[model samples]
Target: MNYALFIARKIYNGGDNTQKVSKPAINIATIGVAIGLAVMIISVCVVLGFKHSIRDKIVGFGSHITVANFLTLQSSEQYPIVINDSLTKELKTIPGVKHIQRYAYTQGILKTNSDFLGVVLKGVGPDFDSTFIHNNMVEGVIPRFSDTENQQNIVISKTIADKLKLKVGQRLFAYFINKQNVRTRKFTIAGIYSTNMKQFDAQVCFTDLYTAKKLNGWEADQYSGAEILVNDFLQLDPISYDVLSKVKNKVDHYGETYSSENIIEQNPQIFSWLDLMDMNVWIILALMIAVAGVTMISGLLIIILERTQMIGILKALGSRNKQIRHIFLWFATFIIGRGLIIGNIIGFGIIFLQKWTGLIKLDPQTYYVSTVPVEINISLIVALNLATLLICVLVLIAPSYLISHIHPAKSMHYE
Candidate 1:
């Protein structure tokens, strides 16, 4: 009993040959919409993927938040702090805290027969979360690193491994200079991992906390800092503030003041660059929507003009302008709906293919990822389709007004 929709469907089916002239225009409009939507979807997925991939890698290297001494923040040398059982228990009780692990850093040079490379030896205890490094392991396995035992085993990055011509199970000598005194230790490479992030891969290696602590001449109860993992990244800022308030004024046994910082604060340059990608995506979405709207307007105008005589007969039979406008809007909806279906198919197909096969590759040095990344968010895709259909119909409303201006008698003779 919906007369407007009924008439729109009849016109769309083109029972008569009169609609033939508008067929090509309609097809072009649908293609325009399809292409525009596909581009928008791909852009959104790729950008979101890039942001998440880079963010996770950075967090993997350190953690969501770090609580360290004030001196450690100012210099590479980690001033000792006491992260004893009492302090660990207090931090774990915080609402968002997931895990707390002890860590220390000491700088040294690994020497082989012909080459030497400087690296920061990251010391981790038995509680160290090796999930990230394990996933990225190219060869060998993570050793049992303990605070009480010195296994003399270390994990090196593929970048470092390649540069020093080193392999797992190879024994090498490392020299550490403390207050103008040179100390030497022999270590066996237990694992090799690669994150493809140059900053970490080139300069960081992992060892047992006891080894790192001994190099820094620290006691068993003292460490460089505590890395805190949170349940949700969205709560990082508030959790960091809560942690700072808890420990900021508290002095360690070594008389060191604690400072807390989140991953974003620790590496502002990389995060700022990621934030700028959002503006680029916004600009692309605007341009695509505009292109789709313009094409739909042109198609609507052509359909209206071609049906001039029908409009005249309907108006002569007492049809209102508003009713006539609804008919064309319904018709436009059909075209948009068809285009959206095709667009979704094409867009999702490309995304799945890329995600599974990683057919497209990028330079890790520049992009921080070896393959093009894509994220498929169902809610976002649905919103995009609904918004596209609504905007295209709204843009056609102005052109639909041309129907009211045409005199019935004149339009009947328009042919």
Candidate 2:
């Protein structure tokens, strides 16, 4: 083992007899590996970052899951339901439940002197976790509902504020229409936020739950729905089913029955699009690995040809075939490791630069985000490197077998 390792070191360091001619092929293989790995790292980080960004925005607009009256189906958000203490407690007991907040909404239009835009007046109680949306706030602060009275403050999106020429602390009239009459209320702009989720941003504004209930003529205990948050979003499907099973056929105070809807189900198209990115990422990974592997194979064959006389000398000295193979395999391992180090440095440097500087820009109207996003998952990075190393080592196996077939007498005499 020590002799084999010594031979590997000499070959890897270009200190062996074949060093001068094999150097270029080895360098080419290393460069190929570096480029392939860098592409893979960027692809994974960007795809996961995009998925996380979009999913968080959707969940921020509507939590991971919703429990509401059966009438508050996926297509519409107009129905009303009252929260039952027992049902809420039961939901809290369910595994993975992170937060439960009361929400109410009614259709309304915000009017300015020259322009008016329609929006859904979404109201949240004190239980709402403002942290998710707070990060996306471009101006002002998220409002906390007061228990003493109905808060007249509302949070509107930048899109809404821009269209209506509204600003923080500005007052506007929002008119809610019902079957019998249209009720109008004056509201103060508490904050402005931008998720760049055009559809939700254009149609929704945040306010106190009491205000939404009052606008809809609902009683003190009533809400349109309860937004449910969970700890692990990837576990959302099973959690949604668990929530549905627990809340299904359950009745609210006004004899309304309840059901649960998860964010993925409610926004299928967005999630489906996100899923498609997985296939894209896999294809990229496969192609890159193939390129790197092919390059390494070519480099290995070149190294073998250049060192044919060395192999004959080693075999003539009674060195076994397996030992000769280990030398080349170890050499290949060093090349791959070097490439990984360089690739990681360059790839992570680019990722960090983009993260801090926002160098890459995207169209918010199309992608729901303004800048290219990236996430550095350490486990993923480690796995990628390990898998690449393993695959490259395995691919180098067949090529190394050429050592065993080399005859000492013929190779040594072949010019």
Top-scoring candidate (lDDT): 1
What is the clash count of model 2? 0
Model 2 TM-score (2 dp): 0.96
Cα lDDT tens digits, model 1, 72-156, are: 8777657888888898899998999999999989999999999999999999989999999999999999998989878999999
In order, the Cα lDDT scores of the candidates are 0.91, 0.89
Q: Ten consecutive residues with minimal summed lDDT in candidate 1?
A: 14-23
Model 2, C-alpha of 54: deviation from truth (Å): 0.7
Root-mean-square deviation of each candidate, in angstroms? 1.4, 1.5
lDDT of 2 by residue, 186-232 (tens): 99999999989999999889998888888888887888888999999
Off by over 4 Å in 1: 16-18
